[model samples]
Target: MFFATTALALLIERFIGYPDILVRTIGHPVQWIGAFIAWLDARLNPESEPGNRLAGMLALLALLVVTGGLALAVALALRKLPYGWVAEAIIATPFLAQKSLAGHVRAVADGLDRSLAEGRSAVSRIVGRDPEQLDRSGVARAALESLGENASDGIVAPAFWLALLGLPGIALYKAINTADSMIGHRSPRYLAFGWAAARLDDLVNLPCARLTGLLFALAAYFSSRTSAKAAFAAMRRDAHRHVSPNAGWPESALAGALGVKLGGPRAYGGRHVDLATMGDGKSELDANDIRDGLSLYGDALSLLAVIAVLLALAF
Candidate 1:
């Protein structure tokens, strides 16, 4: 199932690519599916209790199955509809955004080089951190950090799950990720309720995150700015140091791959958050550095697509 889905997805990605209208159309159905799932969740468990945890878990599992089936059904349904393979390909293409990912990262650097305010506004769309006080270097780092983390969340993780489990797998992963983003927080009210969602999201991301590092390293080897060997070594040494077991893998690899330091101190919600810096070289980052990071990141994704193609062929 994984092989077939990945093969078809990769082919669609290579040929038709992502179209804005296609992405927008996908959102309509995904929203309806998500709303139906949420309604069911609320009706099944209205209040929090020890037993509710078990019930919620069961409900989520059932939801995963149902949503997965629906995604597959929708894909098949699309195939039989008008406009032939071109339209179906467009529908599948938005699900993977390899080219757009690199373009957006480049825009951040462009905005920062022009003006800090411009940089902040452009980056704020991509990151949750406050952008107002960010200096030139801070803007670059934030953009790079977002690239690292989102490479997993927005691209690789979805591909990984979908490849393994088909539309159902991707839908299940997205649903869980959405739940975590919505309520899987550490706030007082959600401490207990969001625990499962958070843990499950982490588990889903673990392997894909590590694979992200490996891809970055491969990209570094092909690029002129950095050394892939050093990137791999640094990833092995520094990946576990971050608070998130999964995030550190890609961030550390990207830091070593680009020869720039990332993941330092920052402010959030009026609170100081100290973070472990990845890589030991190049404390200062500029627009050129951001470009280098994006290029290497692009290479990493290219490597991922190639591997996905190869895997699909092999299996």
Candidate 2:
């Protein structure tokens, strides 16, 4: 049932995506979670307090309890309805973002075709790096990297949790991820308070990140860009070089698969981060590279769908 639910949700999201009307009407689950996190942070994480770490933990715990309990109740209620698995799938559909991820990445490519300024603007919507600092190659790299990393975060992770624990599991994971995004950073303001959110997000993403990389490797094998062996080898060698414990997996895999080098020094906000580069391929990127990356993303998603179907059959 879990597998079927996951498969259906993925398919629906792939074809139609979340409708704008629905989003405008009820807002997103993540937005609601973010609002709650913001409220908690405002009340509990005062910078003047030295004990914000504990307060942050308490806030996170409260959030988990509220989100999990509400999700479980919704799941139970859905189970009482006719064709409840379909209902569960509908509820879960918005959580997966394969179509949207691919769309945004493709839009970056389209924007690059127009001009560098447009490219930077398009890529900025998906990445946090300072767009003004990025050149043509940098903009393309940013888009590809965002596509690879978000493939895991926005698509595979939710599917993984949903398969394991159904709707409530995915809900809990989304809540944790949202909190991490909202407050997980090295800044003095968030370093202690956001530690739990960041660590938990990393823990939950560990398996999914690797799995997403493997899927990309398979996609590379199927495509003409690069071989699966090269993708896997690059991932093993370069994945550790990334600042993120998990992000490096898919990013490196895609870099190797596309015969491009990624993850060199880049600026965030105003600070320069001298990070190790991934892949031994070309450093220069263009609009074509973005297209290739999107293709790889699509192929990897297809691979994941197959796995989901197999899991459904097996269990």
For each candidate, give its TM-score against the true structure.
Answer: 0.84, 0.97
Best by TM-score: 2
Every candidate's CA RMSD: 3.7, 1.2
Clashing pairs in 1: 68-168
Candidate 1 residue lDDT tens string, 146-218: 8898788767887888777665666777777766665466765456555677789899999989988888888
Angstrom error at residue 262, model 2: 0.7
Predictions in order: lDDT: 0.74, 0.91
Runs off by more than 4 Å, candidate 1: 14-18, 23-59, 72-92
lDDT at 118, model 2: 97
lDDT of 1: 0.74
Which candidate should be chosen as best, given lDDT against the real structure? Answer: 2
Model 2: how far residue 187 lies from native, Å: 1.1
